[model samples]
Target: MATERMAFDDLPPAVLAGVESHAGEIVKAEMVSQGFNSEIAARVFTANGAFFVKGLRADHKRVWTQRREAEVNPFLRGIAPALRWQTEDAGWVLLGFEALNGHHADYSPGSPDLPKVADVLSRLGEVGCPDIELRHMEQRLERYAAKPSDLAHFAGNSLVHTDLNNENVMVDGPAYLVDWAWASRGAAWLDAAYWVVWLMAAGGHDPQSAERWAGRIPAWQTAAPEAVTAFALATVNVWEEIAGEDPDPWTAGIRDASRRWAEHRKAA
Candidate 1:
């Protein structure tokens, strides 16, 4: 699902003008090569200040995600970099963010960044789900669940950032979660479960150690054993489909880690 990247200067003249209308004249722009969602991702220095900008063509299939991120930004003030401005013009829709100063969180075993990530997830669980348009977790996983009834385990009104890839979290003085496009309403405990999978794949933590780290999150204590087991299995099905479609190293890694976690859950 990665979009083809575009350089800042390659944008249409009108699109560049629109960006400057909100951010003042662009002095310098550096392409950010990490994330996969945005077609155009960069850090721009304007007379006003520095800001992170990401956008996609209006006709792109995944363009809806651009609007989703903007809608969800108001609720993520402390947990994410603030949205400073957004402009849609000349066939492109762009958003400018506050340009957080930090590096992606390190999920490797025994790293100090782990505790900072825990704090961010704990705070995210407390945010009330807004009345805006958002998908529910059960609906998202229904096609992959073991049975229709088992989907209830994922239903809730709490806000959930369903994607917990290490790159989605930034760490410095205070950790921040980025990429709100996949945010959904779901059970509070599900985010902790998502983190467990990433911990194994990105941190080399075994299932037991991953769950131990998940225990640091307050919501994880509320998760029932059967619910977690069901989630582990559903995660395998979800990633299997994703890896099958994409056939990439990253997707394969997640699919393999998900299967290992499911195997451990079944044995327990």
Candidate 2:
């Protein structure tokens, strides 16, 4: 479905109204899927500056997801983009922010930015998370395991930008992480580990660097290796279920990494 075309007109009325409310005049709008979430980017000219109004679909999980993200965004501003505003009356979560000036990170071979990406990931680790009980790898794994075909692998909780692919990251002055719908507490290594597989799947063939990146995660160093591997495998399995037959390269990469980690777990 990656290549399938979706029209903006088909969007829910609530989504359109929410965008219109934020944006006095909608100059342009586009349907973009950043991971599992379907978002609409609406351009508007405001008094301060031109802003991109983002609207997330009101699904079964949107309410709690938005609330959790909104709660934590203040702490994550320097580490990631801020969540501007969210409204429930319109059945849409609205976020307005200054449009990013840089292009998405390309994870192909010979890309000059792998280390930079690693640096960003490392920096992300330093931002402390509150002891809030959000979703974790173990619970997600159980959900996927129960209905394996319906979902993919599950990785239980740590603070994770679960959808950290190239597009989700933009390098303006500094690398900015966007898209928080799937953001949850999971295994600390799972985010970097998942990104490593995503980068490789996008033609980034730096397994050694990927391993190094994974090693840098504090959770991996502190947590039992077996627990970490189980979480990683569960995460991969959840993706595999979501990805189905035509899995993205990133999904495939995660699957491979999960297997290797699983083997290591057995060995340990």
Candidate 3:
């Protein structure tokens, strides 16, 4: 479902006051349309400079995602937009970030951004998951896995940004990952597997070509074929659960893509 958005002027006086206190007087505020998770996403111009801001009401069910984003920001550093400030005031929670003059990454076939995206993933694969409370990959996918023991293949110390869709990435001097709400701690190759589903969704790649792209990362290349297959099947099951309820076109498409990849793995 599309998230409802709020314009800067629609912000409560207390919310605006709190932001300006840290960001300086806002001269301009341009709404950003890339992410659906936040109620407010914008580029605000302050005397200090341009910064990106995203927020949600404190009582919203997804309010915990805002805190997760904030908690993971410092660890992301060059991998994500830098966190500038955060606030909890006037019944809202907001996070501010460095506004990059960048666009959402292009995942379509032949786009040069693919290599850049690969590079970003390679770097992230090197960072061991930090010691903090985070959902483990097994825990997050427990409900979707075909068998509980299949979940064992997913355990590891690597930090992963499970939502690797292009919209959560910015193609800048270097690709920066955004939207840490779904970050997971798991096997390093897990992220590469997730990206395969998204790459196929963007078109032009069958399951085979998509795996080749994922293979560019060392972690993925070294991942056990059976473990990767288990992950692919789990993805299919997840989309199945989602589509069974709402069945949006996009969800159906991703479900098909994950199924194809899982089938190919079984055949191999």
Candidate 4:
């Protein structure tokens, strides 16, 4: 059975027309609703094979995010598939690419891939990110700190996929990190710690196992345990403040864990 094209009723008509011009025949469309960002999909059947159409927001911040991904993806081609084409016509930034096959790393408890996922994340940390000035971690931290939020006096600059939940990681072939909107320079340990928090919330938290996995990544190995803990705690605090009315269970657990980890860090 042929899949039906998904439609976003709210999308501007001009944007839809642009998509139709590029896509030719829209066979299927599905709204990707996993993260905080907004995204839409339209699968079209062409002569070669099915092409995936991604309609993304092209605001100043989001445009910078796309530019960063485009900048780094070429270098990390072997690590994961990179964006193919980026076109903006009629207020819509349309991205077309060959879709990858795999599932996000939402591993169940005791799943063999848990440690492997950690190893992949560690490898990802090693990829070189060119210097860019669009999203400044220090600036974001300072601004957020000034507000009456729990995250104050917490800052570091390491390449981080700011939203490193299980849904953003794939488990097939070489593990691939998806969703590049939030990727930015931040503390490296925070990425791994964020994963730990995410896994725990999903009922897969295992410190002993996580520690062993961390051992595999040399970058993670050199990191100060205290720093990693601090990053983890700070990450949670920031998320909690951003969450506002829509509280995420995963982030809530991370906030609680950060508090505990902070106390332990002080004792040591």
Clashes of each: 0, 22, 0, 3
Per-prediction TM-score: 0.97, 0.71, 0.96, 0.75
Q: In terms of TM-score, how similar is model 1 to the real structure?
A: 0.97
Compare the candidates by TM-score and give the number of the best one: 1
Assess each prediction's global lDDT (C-alpha) against the native.
Answer: 0.92, 0.59, 0.89, 0.58
Deviation from native of the Cα of residue 21 in model 1, angstroms: 1.2
Hey, what RMSD does candidate 4 come out at? 5.5
Q: Estimate, for each residue in 112-208, the C-alpha lDDT of model 1 and write its tens digit.
A: 9999999999998888899889999999999988788779999998999988998899885889999888989999999999999999999479999
The number of the candidate with the highest lDDT is 1
- Residue-wise lDDT of candidate 4 within 125-182, one digit each (tens)? 7765557553545455553332433232234455666566677777776677766666
Candidate 3 clash pair list = none
- Which sections of candidate 2 miss by over 4 Å? 1-35, 57-63, 131-133, 143-158, 204-206, 216-220, 245-268
Give, for candidate 2, the lowest lDDT window spanning 10 residues: 149-158
By the lDDT metric, which is better: model 1 or model 3? 1
- Any runs in candidate 3 off by more than 4 Å, and if so which? none
